[model samples]
Target: MAPAHRDLADIIITDELAKRASEPPDYLREKLAFRDLADDMADNPKAVLPRLVRLAMEACGAESAGISLLEHEVREFRWFGLHGALAAFEGTRTPLDYSPCGVTLQQNAPVLMKHPETVYGWIRSAGISIPEVLLVPLHLRRPAEDGGAGTLWVVGSEPGFFSLEHVRVLTELAAFSSVAIRMIQAEEVVQAALQEQEQLTREMSHRIKNLLAITDGMLRLTARTATTKEELVAKMSGRFLALANANQLVRRPFAHDTISRVGLQQLMETILKPYERVSTKGLDVALGDHAINSMALVFHELATNAAKYGALSRDEGQVSVGWSIHDDRLEVTWNESGGPRVCQPETRGFGSTLIETTVRRHNGTIRYSWLDDGLTAAIILPLSSLAR
Candidate 1:
């Protein structure tokens, strides 16, 4: 289960993938074959490797050919693409420790082994024979001398069936396979980015529509509650500005930083601390990795209402926030005291609607109690949404 690396230090991988000192066999024919495959790759990158493996077989005159990529995660070499005799075994895997492909990588050059099946039991178990297999290290992310990747291999039907000419052909093919793998990987990355951008555009459009609806609701509430036209104008202007600021903070990073999540304590500071007269305790428990935008706006509305009508409205009033962990949920309480006598509003404002909408979006529950001293809002969010 070790690399056949005895005296492997004697070999130089620096120029192994380069063209041979002498001309390759059937130079014009091989050139035509590779040029055709290059065009095919531009059309369908996913199919390029298989076609390249077929070309490796034809140019090297091997019975079977394949490309085995090292899956370092699982410590195995997977037959990524193949052609000829062992095509049925495509997608199969062999232990990296025991694979000829691994030896080729460690050697950092083409490895020709005669009757290797006797040493590798897995090959014998597959009910196929590898009398002679020429494996060339594939230079993927780095050259073979530094950190090679996969292997481009060709198998002959009998011992002494391969030669130096076969090795030259396969080494070039191995270089080509490396390029193909990177091209395919690059295409996949570009595609994923495009899809993410499209999703973000759609999401932004939907949020804008929701914000408009919330704005409309706020306008109706402000008109109903404003005592004078001048008062209405002042309140409307401030409220519109606050909404704009909250919208800016609520925007989430959609790139690699999407893994980040915010907690209620941080959310409160981000949206409430600017107005002051608010404090918190016992909010150190773990939180669900919910979307911070909705919860952020929720706190924004709540704090706005408090400054206008709740504890924060009076200099003597105080608001305390705290939370506790339950079996499968977190219960957070926002308690206010020392303001005007607590009483439920006769009509619900857009602020209340906004709070309810945001809480529900994260599968959380919220309730408001109009106690004798002040208003207490208790919200519970499911712990199941934890990132872990």
Candidate 2:
């Protein structure tokens, strides 16, 4: 069996941490100097992490400065942020167990190493020759099982280059970094929650408007049929029930389905089921949601007019509704037969106007013919309108 590894504290001190700890008064003064700045930087890790490394390099007059975060899953130390001579090394990874930063993490204290390339093989591979280094562990408020987080370090090109004062400065910076990281994390959580709430609000508003539009169309169609107040009330009640059923199906949430498109066959059956006592058939072509929505209003107007004056007015009357795709355009035909003699009205009514307007809105064309037996209506919708 391999021998157990020794604790980091037992291997290397070199009088660096002890020398800094000996001067408590000077260290306390340094902490007091940056207390306000630390408070101000606590909410911005992006700004604070980079500034901390820059300040460490400036204050200690070091050749390079950086912070390495411990990636537990890979057992590597990635340069989270950097400044000064080694700025290009940001995001580079080093072996966690065999570097000076690892020693600082394991000891949970500051460590000073002289001629670190002798111990860390990555330094030699990268052609970096740091004569001395100072690293301070940043213990974040994480679960103990995570083994905490990272280290802040400064490097020098000459032996015994980093003094006790440099260690004190880096330790103070690491403390501020821990608070900044926590604050940034909390801010991200709050921002995400707010975004989710906004999306839900927008969806609710859209659904309300859709319900209102459907209600208005039903009211207009029902008004055209009823001559007396009692007839109006009875017709409205039945139409409202049909509207409710169609709305329920259209508004249902489904994976990979959006509000802009609905099933063509399903919509027709929902709206026409009330008038099915008279033979009604045909709507087989596949169309998109936008086309379906516009067509729903058109069909509602056509069906309402037929029930009042056309084929659906009599028990023996029949209606045929179907669509065919031809050369990048959809042609939908509505035929009514077996009722009273058909004649064109002297003036255009709301139902006729509604059908025309709805078809035009979807970039489609409509034609009406008052034949001797029945009314024939044809609508042509271009496929380009439904591409999206």
In order, candidate lDDTs are 0.74, 0.71
lDDT of 2 by residue, 1-388 (tens): 1112334444354585444432233655556547755765754555777777787787777889988988889999899768877888889988778888777787777887766655556776786766678888876775365575888888876765777767767877888777777777788777766765666567668766865886687577668866898987876665556556555654424322244345556677777777864344454555454455566667776888888898889888888877777998878788888878889999887667767877887788999889876889998988777542
Q: Cα deviation of 128 in candidate 2 (Å)?
A: 7.0
RMSD of each: 5.3, 8.8
Error (Å) of candidate 2 at residue 236 is: 4.8
Residues 197-315, candidate 1: write the lDDT tens digits: 88777767876787687677768877887789997887677656655654554444656534344455666665676777788776554333234445556666777777888888899
Give per-model TM-scores.
Answer: 0.78, 0.51
Give per-residue lDDT, candidate 1, residue 306. 77
What local lDDT does model 2 show for residue 22? 29
The local lDDT score (0 to 100) that residue 122 gets in candidate 2 is 70
- Model 1 clashes, total count: 0
Clashes of each: 0, 2
